[model samples]
Target: MQPTMEFLTSEEAIQVDAALLSSKEKFSTRLAIYALRCLKQIAAEKEISVEAVTAQQVSDWIKKDENIQQQLELDSNFELFFTRLVLSSLKPLKQIAQSEQQPIENLTLKQVVSWFEQESKIRQE
Candidate 1:
Protein backbone atom coordinates (compact mmCIF):
# COMPACT_ATOMS: atom_id res chain seq x y z
CA MET A 1 0.00 0.00 0.00
CA GLN A 2 1.02 3.54 -0.60
CA PRO A 3 2.16 5.60 2.34
CA THR A 4 0.01 8.38 3.74
CA MET A 5 0.89 12.07 3.43
CA GLU A 6 1.93 12.16 7.07
CA PHE A 7 4.44 9.40 6.52
CA LEU A 8 5.75 10.95 3.33
CA THR A 9 6.03 14.38 4.93
CA SER A 10 8.02 12.95 7.83
CA GLU A 11 10.31 11.10 5.44
CA GLU A 12 10.86 14.22 3.38
CA ALA A 13 11.59 16.22 6.51
CA ILE A 14 14.25 13.69 7.48
CA GLN A 15 15.73 13.84 4.00
CA VAL A 16 15.81 17.62 4.19
CA ASP A 17 17.59 17.50 7.53
CA ALA A 18 20.21 15.12 6.17
CA ALA A 19 20.71 17.29 3.11
CA LEU A 20 21.13 20.36 5.29
CA LEU A 21 23.68 18.65 7.52
CA SER A 22 25.78 17.51 4.60
CA SER A 23 25.44 20.79 2.72
CA LYS A 24 28.15 22.66 4.64
CA GLU A 25 30.63 22.12 1.78
CA LYS A 26 28.31 23.21 -1.04
CA PHE A 27 25.57 25.73 -0.35
CA SER A 28 23.79 25.79 -3.70
CA THR A 29 23.95 22.04 -4.13
CA ARG A 30 22.57 21.54 -0.65
CA LEU A 31 19.61 23.83 -1.33
CA ALA A 32 18.78 21.91 -4.48
CA ILE A 33 18.99 18.65 -2.57
CA TYR A 34 16.53 19.87 0.03
CA ALA A 35 14.16 21.21 -2.58
CA LEU A 36 14.19 17.93 -4.43
CA ARG A 37 13.63 16.15 -1.15
CA CYS A 38 10.55 18.31 -0.57
CA LEU A 39 9.41 17.60 -4.10
CA LYS A 40 9.76 13.89 -3.52
CA GLN A 41 7.33 14.24 -0.67
CA ILE A 42 4.71 15.73 -2.96
CA ALA A 43 5.46 13.19 -5.69
CA ALA A 44 5.09 10.35 -3.22
CA GLU A 45 1.70 11.64 -2.17
CA LYS A 46 0.69 12.08 -5.79
CA GLU A 47 1.92 8.57 -6.64
CA ILE A 48 4.46 9.78 -9.20
CA SER A 49 7.77 9.70 -7.25
CA VAL A 50 8.24 5.94 -7.63
CA GLU A 51 8.90 6.27 -11.38
CA ALA A 52 9.56 9.08 -13.77
CA VAL A 53 6.37 10.12 -15.45
CA THR A 54 6.18 9.33 -19.16
CA ALA A 55 5.92 11.90 -21.91
CA GLN A 56 2.28 10.96 -22.25
CA GLN A 57 1.71 11.94 -18.66
CA VAL A 58 3.25 15.29 -19.33
CA SER A 59 1.16 15.71 -22.44
CA ASP A 60 -1.98 14.95 -20.52
CA TRP A 61 -1.29 17.53 -17.81
CA ILE A 62 0.27 20.34 -19.77
CA LYS A 63 -1.41 22.62 -22.21
CA LYS A 64 -1.08 22.20 -25.98
CA ASP A 65 -0.25 25.87 -26.37
CA GLU A 66 3.08 26.33 -28.04
CA ASN A 67 3.99 29.17 -25.69
CA ILE A 68 3.43 27.02 -22.62
CA GLN A 69 5.46 24.19 -24.08
CA GLN A 70 8.26 26.55 -24.92
CA GLN A 71 8.32 27.94 -21.42
CA LEU A 72 8.35 24.49 -19.84
CA GLU A 73 11.18 23.40 -22.13
CA LEU A 74 13.46 25.89 -20.40
CA ASP A 75 13.88 23.42 -17.51
CA SER A 76 15.06 19.83 -17.69
CA ASN A 77 12.66 17.10 -16.63
CA PHE A 78 14.53 16.79 -13.37
CA GLU A 79 14.04 20.49 -12.74
CA LEU A 80 10.42 20.51 -13.80
CA PHE A 81 9.66 17.47 -11.67
CA PHE A 82 10.87 19.19 -8.52
CA THR A 83 9.26 22.46 -9.55
CA ARG A 84 5.94 20.71 -9.61
CA LEU A 85 6.71 19.16 -6.25
CA VAL A 86 7.54 22.51 -4.67
CA LEU A 87 4.51 24.19 -6.20
CA SER A 88 2.32 21.48 -4.74
CA SER A 89 3.81 21.97 -1.30
CA LEU A 90 3.35 25.72 -1.49
CA LYS A 91 -0.34 25.58 -0.71
CA PRO A 92 0.17 24.45 2.84
CA LEU A 93 3.21 26.62 3.26
CA LYS A 94 1.19 29.60 2.15
CA GLN A 95 -1.47 28.75 4.67
CA ILE A 96 1.05 28.61 7.45
CA ALA A 97 2.60 31.89 6.40
CA GLN A 98 -0.79 33.57 6.43
CA SER A 99 -1.67 32.12 9.80
CA GLU A 100 1.58 33.42 11.18
CA GLN A 101 1.24 36.82 9.47
CA GLN A 102 4.31 36.21 7.36
CA PRO A 103 4.85 36.64 3.65
CA ILE A 104 4.83 33.54 1.52
CA GLU A 105 7.31 35.17 -0.80
CA ASN A 106 9.75 35.04 2.05
CA LEU A 107 9.93 31.32 1.54
CA THR A 108 13.27 30.15 0.19
CA LEU A 109 12.90 29.67 -3.54
CA LYS A 110 16.64 29.84 -4.12
CA GLN A 111 17.22 27.11 -1.61
CA VAL A 112 14.59 25.00 -3.32
CA VAL A 113 16.09 25.60 -6.75
CA SER A 114 19.51 24.86 -5.40
CA TRP A 115 18.41 21.68 -3.75
CA PHE A 116 16.64 20.54 -6.90
CA GLU A 117 19.70 21.15 -9.04
CA GLN A 118 22.01 19.45 -6.55
CA GLU A 119 19.85 16.36 -6.20
CA SER A 120 19.61 16.08 -9.98
CA LYS A 121 23.36 16.20 -10.28
CA ILE A 122 23.76 13.55 -7.61
CA ARG A 123 21.30 11.27 -9.39
CA GLN A 124 23.13 11.74 -12.68
CA GLU A 125 26.44 10.95 -10.97
Candidate 2:
Protein backbone atom coordinates (compact mmCIF):
# COMPACT_ATOMS: atom_id res chain seq x y z
CA MET A 1 0.00 0.00 0.00
CA GLN A 2 0.99 3.67 0.36
CA PRO A 3 2.71 5.49 3.20
CA THR A 4 1.73 7.91 5.94
CA MET A 5 0.81 11.37 4.62
CA GLU A 6 -0.03 14.56 6.40
CA PHE A 7 -3.69 15.53 6.22
CA LEU A 8 -2.92 19.19 5.74
CA THR A 9 -0.04 21.64 5.53
CA SER A 10 -0.15 25.05 7.14
CA GLU A 11 -0.32 26.68 3.72
CA GLU A 12 -3.05 24.31 2.59
CA ALA A 13 -5.10 24.93 5.72
CA ILE A 14 -4.88 28.63 5.01
CA GLN A 15 -5.97 28.18 1.39
CA VAL A 16 -8.87 26.00 2.51
CA ASP A 17 -10.13 28.92 4.56
CA ALA A 18 -10.29 31.04 1.40
CA ALA A 19 -12.13 28.47 -0.71
CA LEU A 20 -15.59 28.73 0.84
CA LEU A 21 -16.44 25.09 0.26
CA SER A 22 -19.42 23.35 1.78
CA SER A 23 -18.63 21.00 4.63
CA LYS A 24 -18.74 17.91 2.45
CA GLU A 25 -16.56 19.46 -0.24
CA LYS A 26 -14.09 20.55 2.37
CA PHE A 27 -13.90 17.00 3.68
CA SER A 28 -13.32 15.65 0.19
CA THR A 29 -10.65 18.24 -0.65
CA ARG A 30 -8.81 17.40 2.55
CA LEU A 31 -8.89 13.70 1.75
CA ALA A 32 -7.72 14.33 -1.82
CA ILE A 33 -4.79 16.36 -0.54
CA TYR A 34 -3.81 13.51 1.73
CA ALA A 35 -4.17 11.05 -1.13
CA LEU A 36 -1.85 13.11 -3.32
CA ARG A 37 0.83 12.91 -0.67
CA CYS A 38 0.42 9.16 -0.36
CA LEU A 39 0.57 8.70 -4.12
CA LYS A 40 3.74 10.79 -4.35
CA GLN A 41 5.44 8.78 -1.62
CA ILE A 42 4.40 5.49 -3.15
CA ALA A 43 5.64 6.49 -6.58
CA ALA A 44 8.98 7.67 -5.23
CA GLU A 45 9.59 4.52 -3.23
CA LYS A 46 8.50 2.23 -6.05
CA GLU A 47 10.57 4.09 -8.69
CA ILE A 48 7.48 4.86 -10.73
CA SER A 49 5.22 7.75 -11.60
CA VAL A 50 2.44 8.82 -9.27
CA GLU A 51 -0.26 7.66 -11.67
CA ALA A 52 1.37 4.27 -11.79
CA VAL A 53 0.88 3.59 -8.09
CA THR A 54 -1.70 0.88 -7.52
CA ALA A 55 -4.57 0.81 -5.08
CA GLN A 56 -3.07 -2.20 -3.40
CA GLN A 57 0.15 -0.27 -2.81
CA VAL A 58 -1.80 2.57 -1.24
CA SER A 59 -3.83 0.17 0.90
CA ASP A 60 -0.69 -1.50 2.15
CA TRP A 61 0.87 1.85 2.93
CA ILE A 62 -2.15 2.92 4.95
CA LYS A 63 -2.08 -0.32 6.91
CA LYS A 64 1.51 0.36 7.94
CA ASP A 65 0.86 3.82 9.29
CA GLU A 66 1.01 3.98 13.10
CA ASN A 67 -2.21 5.96 13.38
CA ILE A 68 -4.05 3.51 11.18
CA GLN A 69 -2.46 0.65 13.10
CA GLN A 70 -3.99 1.99 16.31
CA GLN A 71 -7.40 2.26 14.68
CA LEU A 72 -7.05 -1.22 13.24
CA GLU A 73 -6.49 -2.60 16.75
CA LEU A 74 -9.78 -1.06 17.86
CA ASP A 75 -11.84 -1.98 14.80
CA SER A 76 -11.19 -4.10 11.76
CA ASN A 77 -14.03 -2.36 9.95
CA PHE A 78 -12.38 1.04 10.32
CA GLU A 79 -9.35 -0.17 8.42
CA LEU A 80 -11.43 -1.37 5.48
CA PHE A 81 -13.63 1.70 5.40
CA PHE A 82 -10.80 4.18 5.79
CA THR A 83 -8.73 2.42 3.17
CA ARG A 84 -11.59 2.66 0.73
CA LEU A 85 -12.13 6.32 1.50
CA VAL A 86 -8.49 7.05 0.76
CA LEU A 87 -8.45 4.91 -2.36
CA SER A 88 -11.56 6.61 -3.66
CA SER A 89 -9.77 9.96 -3.46
CA LEU A 90 -6.90 8.99 -5.71
CA LYS A 91 -8.83 9.33 -8.94
CA PRO A 92 -9.57 13.03 -8.64
CA LEU A 93 -6.17 13.78 -7.24
CA LYS A 94 -4.56 12.13 -10.22
CA GLN A 95 -6.88 13.92 -12.59
CA ILE A 96 -5.96 17.27 -11.12
CA ALA A 97 -2.29 16.45 -11.24
CA GLN A 98 -2.59 15.32 -14.83
CA SER A 99 -4.51 18.37 -15.96
CA GLU A 100 -2.06 20.71 -14.29
CA GLN A 101 0.91 18.96 -15.91
CA GLN A 102 2.62 18.76 -12.55
CA PRO A 103 3.73 16.18 -10.06
CA ILE A 104 1.08 15.30 -7.47
CA GLU A 105 3.10 16.74 -4.59
CA ASN A 106 3.44 20.10 -6.29
CA LEU A 107 -0.30 20.72 -6.47
CA THR A 108 -1.44 23.53 -4.25
CA LEU A 109 -4.60 23.74 -2.16
CA LYS A 110 -6.02 26.44 -4.39
CA GLN A 111 -5.68 24.17 -7.40
CA VAL A 112 -7.43 21.29 -5.65
CA VAL A 113 -10.25 23.37 -4.22
CA SER A 114 -10.80 25.10 -7.53
CA TRP A 115 -11.00 21.78 -9.32
CA PHE A 116 -13.62 20.53 -6.90
CA GLU A 117 -15.62 23.69 -7.25
CA GLN A 118 -15.59 23.31 -11.01
CA GLU A 119 -16.61 19.69 -10.68
CA SER A 120 -19.48 20.53 -8.37
CA LYS A 121 -20.76 22.98 -10.94
CA ILE A 122 -20.47 20.43 -13.71
CA ARG A 123 -22.42 17.84 -11.70
CA GLN A 124 -25.15 20.35 -11.02
CA GLU A 125 -25.48 21.04 -14.73
Among all candidates shown, the one with the greatest lDDT: 2
Lowest lDDT block of 10, candidate 2? 1-10
> Stretches of candidate 1 above 4 Å error?
1-76, 106-125
Q: What is the Cα-based lDDT of residue 70 in candidate 1?
A: 46
Candidate 2, residue 37: Cα displacement in angstroms equals 0.4
Best by TM-score: 2
Give per-residue CA lDDT, model 1, range 14-125, as digits (tens): 5454553345323433333343344444445567631354434433344332334544565556445634653554444444345556544344534443344454566667
lDDT of each: 0.44, 0.78
When summed lDDT is taken over every stretch of 10 residues in candidate 1, the lowest stretch is 2-11
Superposition error at 16 for model 1 (Å): 6.9
Clash count, candidate 2: 7
Clashes of 1: 6
RMSD of each: 15.2, 4.8
